[model samples]
Target: MEHLAYFDCPTGVAGDMCLGALVDAGLPVDVLHQQLSGLPSEVRFTLAVQPVQRQGQRATQVLVHPQGEQPHHRHWAEIRTWLAEAHLPPAVQNWSQGIFQRLAQTEGRVHGMPPEQVGFHEVGAVDAIVDIVGTCIGLHYFNITKIYCSPLPLGSGTVKTAHGIMAVPTPAVLQLCQQRQVPIYDNGIDRELVTPTGAAIVTTLAQGFGRPPALKLERVGWGAGGRELPLANILRLWLGSPPASALTEPVVLLETQVDDMSPQGLAYACERLREGGALDVWIQAITMKKGRQGVLLQVLCHPELVAPCEELLLQETTTLGVRRQWQERRLLPRRLVTVMTDWGEVAVKVAEYTGRRVNVQPEYEDCARIARTHGLPWKQVHQQVLHRFWQDMGQES
Candidate 1:
């Protein structure tokens, strides 16, 4: 069971946009308001869902408005206290802390004060507060287990704000981004592509960076950015499920046969490739026309490393030339874990979540050591290790 949150931030992202995305993803607006009321503050704000169009496509926009009284700006500490007391799930609580910290650092840098000395300006006001808190509430409402986004679209040039004209993507925006690595960039929108509150919220809540992961897409939610543009100002929300399998980011392969190189030196070169995150490396025995037998070395890596690896080949071995190709590959979702086994501790790579690991593979190095010590078949020892992990998980459950 998984939900995919896609950021259509080619225009930039904001807290309002994110909240709108969640609302579009099925989080109820009234439930969001109900949670906000649990906070200690007496402030009043309203959440409005409005229709917005992006690139000729209609999407929903979330608008936060101060319903009656004039809104006042509060400092970071005061706002943090209210949020800490706000009713939220654990993930949402930490998510809120990260958001506020990013917001403060941005505001501080914008005002030319040290990040710690910076306080919230308009962001601390009632409506913006609603935007940030409601985003957290909506996150829980949708039961989104994980959040991910694309590189943020930070517009180029300068933007005029309440504090006067600051650079687009603003000092606050940069500060918030620095707090966490949420991929962001100025892609020529020329207006503020990402806002301080938006950057903080997205960067903090999102789990990892890259193109949206492969998943079972359940629904598509569109969040309006409120401001109109000649183009669309809406954020796209894609809800997905785990696929039986999925295509991943493309990697360009550069390979060639190297027969004359010494095995030790070639092994060293392969180490260097793996260190730089190469996908795979192997060598094959082949015969040349002259009838001399040698090992043919091949290397595979992402396209970006072509130059670096090419340099390594030039300096590390006698490969005169390498061939490059555009190739496609597929991979299963993977993770790591250490399981308790008889040979002490063994790292296990498990596949298929059948409420329990259907296949648990013992780390080969650990198995080898255990087999050598106990004079047991390495394969047999490895099987026992998995049996132990399953027994333990069952007892614990």
Candidate 2:
């Protein structure tokens, strides 16, 4: 089964809430402690999980207390140094770095500075580190490959920050949402619901945003906020495999017979179709009614993009009419991993089924660029990448 985690943010989300829900879901506290042990000795914090009632419903509240005075401001480079020294898994390290990087970028843009020079105030603290890095470790422990979150309820009014009191949906949060294209809405509450850390985590790791996918019920964990609010003030996490029915999604298939279009135009049309969000586009040579060799251009895309894709076909190709139909697609659960090869870092596309990895292939574009740059055969580079990938997987296993 494909393992997935869906974050239900009815009240809102924060770093601590995400971590608490993940820990409460099934991650062992001891394992979390062990994984976090790699952090520098200067950073000390204790994770306390307490049972609380939010709006009369039981929830897990995670409070992270720093052991001593810590720097409230730090540059992105400093944080990266700590992560580089840690002996965490490559995946965890990458995930943690990415989240922080997104935060840094947002902060930098808001404060008019480069990302590496942007000083993190609330996010630079030891507790914030634990919340982010700890969350990554927890996700690794549960082998969570995909995450989905609901549209955030960005509160109204003002929120106190390092830069003094600012409007709700803080600058950092707004930048994060815009950069990642995360959906956000104000539910009329006048307080900060989505924190910077929370925005960074979700924007960085979440693959999709909307209602939970169709999945068989497995486990549920409720993570509570700091104080009681009008709403539940809890984040619900659902862990489960996608339902059998979700294996395929309805998509639109557009096809048209192209007997007169030139090969050049066909190539350009394929590129435009892809650029216009077509899932896949190709041509099949066929013999039309009068023994004339013709080409059939097929475009596959989301059902919603049918009109735009069809328009592009008509605008770019010499097709008078386009036939469209809704089709179901069964897609494998896949993720990309970058592996270090002799040439450089190569991204490997991995497709998994039934909880087991079924296919691993190097990204063709990366291999082609490497081959062209190094004056080597693309096939040789491909083989070398596969070899390195297997070697790395073997070592990790």
Candidate 3:
């Protein structure tokens, strides 16, 4: 299975902190420097590799320094123009612009101005810019096609910044985080932990947030924050093959025989079971103890939700008792990938086995759309999509 890059943010991540960690993870700092070589005199930086601890674990953190005078606030248009024309790689520039765009929107709301009308306050500073741009370049070097982040720990309380002591989680940070499912916690570190720029970069670049998946472990890197604390100054990185696509888990299958239940009655029971969290519930035809035909009610669900759903089975089905037990099954990791179809953009589900692409099928929504537009049978559209995908892959090969 192909691997993925996972960021473990025990301590909150900052733009500089993330960039520093990527550097520690072996990004080409010298190559990154060469691209930013001739920037205006307002920006200067120092990069160093050092060891730090997080909780009780020791890891390396990259420290960045933007000494001397900082730059003045500029409008989004001006900043974006320079970024667009910069000599940086396309991926780096794209990532940086995305982060900045997120911050600009947040600032716009805080200051009661349009995003373009908002000025870059502390974030516009030369050092912050360098930190973000450097991080973008570093990620490009890794050729990270996809990234997933752990839930962010947005610190609590207010901290002093160029914009005054507004709040611990600044307006910009709060605004950016509100739209995402990233988790926030307050551990009494009443300081500014999740910066707006950092939030932008991490969330924009990462596809989703969750714990590490099944993967073959490879190289791991830790980026450290330059702060000296009782705890460690480190950000952990895990580079490995994603966990096995099919995970082995125990599931309970419930069965009950019904000889006198109406189809509607059976449906009601199944619906209730589903509401109670049965994985699947349906009827199967079978011969009963009296040699009479009957419908077999079956439910497959997690062991935990089985009891609650079982009550529904007893109440709705004609059967006096239900048989239940456990079964082992392998579940695949599933995600929907959007493909550009001749009709338009259609969603297709990609199923993987140990990180290898094993199946790709068009989504019902897409199949229906194609059916309506071309006035063809829905099944035909679906079949065509499935057929075309493999053909396209063959052409690519």
Candidate 4:
């Protein structure tokens, strides 16, 4: 029963489209409105969801009609204050804050100003507020634990903005995707598809971007873009659980036997493998041919990293040949959650299966660093973090 959502954005994605798709996927409008009611804004607006035809297919369009105030510029401080005063759910508040933070930081980089000082013009308006906040509320309501997205469509042509007409894939959008390593491409539509608001939300929240993952396909939500295009201009959302039979992908296993590499060199090679994107690396004692003792260096990596990982083994070890194999791995859905303790903040690795949490481990690096800094035993720091996380979880339950 693990829940996941995938955005299939062939046309592109925007804040409104995301909200619309979520609404279309069965998130109640009343609940969305209730949660968004606390936003510290004087402007009044209505979220209208209606059926629309995109190209030849049906989709949902969410239109915002705001009264009393038009789009206006807002500083980072102003938006931060609004979020803080809104009294959102803790998860919603934290997630929404991170999206806006990325937006401001991207804007700051594009405009040559500090992130705190950057002003959001087009994205600071009421509609943008509704889109971002509504999206968060919808996600919270659904209790979605995993998000995957298709390669984003970055349309071309100029777009009018508060700053003036800027290039397609506006500076803020470009910077956001580039910084996050989110993939983007042009489909030659000659229109602006991905807006800063859309980019910020997706880049901030998406765990991976590519083709949709293997899902059970429970419900599909199509979010419509504002413009009509030759191609279907809609964002399709897929919601489901991981396929019951498989939650695994093939990974490359690179192994080498080393007899002469120094301990310092072996450690550095392991470090290099990790830095080069090896999923894991380990050394094992073994007997080579002719009863010669050797260390077996094993590297596990994504298929894409096989070459670099193999090269490191060849260069860093005395082994003449590196063995490669493809191995399938089944993994639990996991993420890092930080727990604030007296010593400091420690990240707990949380793993879930069938929508139930199965294991939670405090990150050793955080515990060790805190132990050294506070002159406490590492075990004590670890125990304190574990205790704090369970206490918080208990209260939430």
Candidate 5:
């Protein structure tokens, strides 16, 4: 079973709040401390977790207290090196570094400097580092396979930072949101709810931002913030297992009909679309209005690529407009396995449904390459690859 986590951020999200939620969801504090102890000697901090009430809602509050004097400002290169030298798990190290990298890039853009040269002020503190790294450690400990989050709530008014009083949602926070195209709304709260650390953490780690997906309801963890507000100042984390049927994901289908473009142009357009990240691109002959012979072009891609794909079609083809629709496609879990054949090694695609192997086929590209190299018939090479795969698996073809 795959474990999934959903961040329902009605108030907002921060690195520390994420850690607290993970802890409240049953992640052991001792485990977090033990793993965090692997950081460099210069990094010194301790976690403090306690039950807290936010606007009458019970939640866990996690605080990262600096243990000793630490640098008030650190460059991105310095933090990157420290994380690389840490003795943490590979996944933890990668994720922690990725979060900080996003922060550095966003700050660099705001301050007109390179990412490596950007100096982190408030986020460079030992406490923020613990919040970022500890959050990764918690997620790794829970074995979370997928993450979903709600649209972030943006607060109003200004906030005090190491750089002095800055506008609410700050420059770095707004830049991060814009980069990820994260959905945000003003909640009429005159405070800085979503900090730069919070924005960087969620925007970097979350796979999608919207309503939670269909899941078997499990435990909910509430991470409380540091202030009281009209609403509960808490970040809610929903953890559960999604059904096998949830394997289906939403995709965008872009379609256009063209009769003026030459066949070569249409083919070129299709290739460009494929190179631009379209999952599939194809064309079919069709009769348009007035009995005109035309071709219907279709492109399948993730929602994020819809704009670029459409732009490519418009620029590369004679189509005046592209029709788009969202679709949910159920997909079989598949993997590639290499098999040794007489000519060379060929890859075979294995597809599974409901945990049972449903189909197996040799990759045509791999088979064709080997066939050309060995001066053998393509069909014969394909058969040999399949035969070798079945033979190695000890199964009858």
Candidate 6:
């Protein structure tokens, strides 16, 4: 059972809002306090969550109150070191570091400085650190396997920062959105909606954007923002598991046509795509404009791999743009079993439907390896493995 969290950011998201939503969804606030206490930071703070109302909607507001003088600024190097030295769980540490790293890189790009040389202003504050780390801890606590988010609503007007007043969807937020090609829209609110911390957290962690995926929703949590707007100023989080009986899962299909690249280059691109997590890669000969012969390269991959797969096509092939679309694919339940043959052990793949075996075949690569070592025909080895698997199954039954 794969558990997922969908961030329905109709208004927007912030680090504190995310923490609030996670806690509202049943993550104990004490868990965050216990885990985040492991961070090696001098600035002491405590997390507090209270039931709040955002434009008449009930939600949770998580606050990080610093207990003492906090650092005015923190450089990327300092934050990285703290995360590395922390005694927190590896997942939490890694996730928190990743979010902060994205923030640093975006700020660096906006300020025309190298990422290592970039120093965080508002994001480097003790509260932001706790917000980021606490969010990761909450996700880890719930065992969230994947994260999906909606198109972020970019607010209007301006916002104040340690760098002084900046435009809404501030420079760091805009840079982060552009990096991932994240979808955004103007929400027509005369204030800052998406904060830099919020943009960094979601852009770094979310696997896909748009509508939520198919899930058997178990719980809903609303995290309220500070300001009250015409609508609910909350980040709604949906927690659930993928349906057990559903055989179809979502995928992305990437297609591009390249007439100039060599056949060898095309083959290499396909190899790279497969290595990069493409479920399937194939090419079809086609005639393009000007009667030039071309091959349409197509890649089927999980939605999360869309960015990398599209990148591979553009970099590895002679194509200007790649087309992508969401798709559903039906899959059969399958398992692997090893069978002992005369030469060695070979793996067989068995596919089942409705509790009955519908298809069974020897793993081609394994059979081929055994055949090469034994100096036997590959076909003979394959047959022997299949025979041995059924024989073993009969004995077991």
Scored against the true structure, residue 394 in model 6 reaches a CA lDDT of 45
> What lDDT does model 3 reach?
0.72
Which runs of model 5 end up more than 4 angstroms from their true locations?
187-190, 216-218, 250-266, 282-299, 303-329, 334-397
lDDT of 2 by residue, 1-397 (tens): 5778888997889999988898789888899889888887877888787888988988888788888777888889999899988888888999999999889888989999998898899999988999999889988887887777788998988977889999988989998887655667877777899999999999888865666666776889888888788988999999877764335444668999978888999999999999989899989999998899999899998654676888899999988899977555677778799989887899999877776777899999999999999999999999999999888884442
Which lDDT tens digits does candidate 4 get at residues 1-397?
5688888888888998898899889988889888888887664788788989988888888988887766588888988988988868988898889999989888888989999998888788888888998888888888888877777889898999888889998888888777655667878788898999998888888866666677788988888888899898888889888775447554668898878878999999999999998899999999988998889899998655666787888887788998877555688778788899987678999887776778889999999899889899999998888889999974452
In model 2, which runs have C-alpha deviations exceeding 4 angstroms?
244-397
Whole-structure CA lDDT of model 5: 0.85
Ranking by lDDT: 6, 5, 2, 4, 3, 1
What C-alpha lDDT values do all the predictions have? 0.71, 0.85, 0.72, 0.84, 0.85, 0.86
Q: In model 4, which regions exceed 4 Å deviation? A: 248-266, 272-278, 281-329, 332-397
Residues 1-397 of candidate 6: C-alpha lDDT, one tens digit per residue: 5789999998988998999999999998777788988988685887678999988789999988887888869899999999999989999999999998988888888989899999988888998999899999989998998998888988888777887888887888888887776768877777788899999999999886777877889999889898899878999999998765444566778999889999999989999999999999999999999999999999999766777898898899989999988666767778888888888777888877766787898889998888788798999988878788888884451
The TM-score, computed over Cα atoms with residue i paired to residue i, of candidate 5 is: 0.77
| Candidate 1 C-alpha lDDT tens digits along 63-151 | 77775765466778877777788777776677777788767766766677775666676787777777887788876666777776677
CA RMSD of each candidate after superposition: 7.7, 10.7, 11.5, 10.0, 4.6, 2.9
Cα shift from native, residue 378, model 5 (Å): 10
Error of 6 at 306 (Å): 4.0
Q: Compute each candidate's TM-score over C-alphas.
A: 0.68, 0.69, 0.62, 0.69, 0.77, 0.88
Among the numbered candidates, top lDDT falls to 6
lDDT of 6 at 197: 92
- Of candidates 4 and 1, the better by TM-score: 4
- lDDT, candidate 2, at 124: 92
Q: Please give, for residues 130-193, the per-residue lDDT of candidate 3 as tens digits.
A: 8788877776676666576776778777677777777768777777666554556665565566
Q: Rank the candidates by TM-score, best first.
A: 6, 5, 4, 2, 1, 3
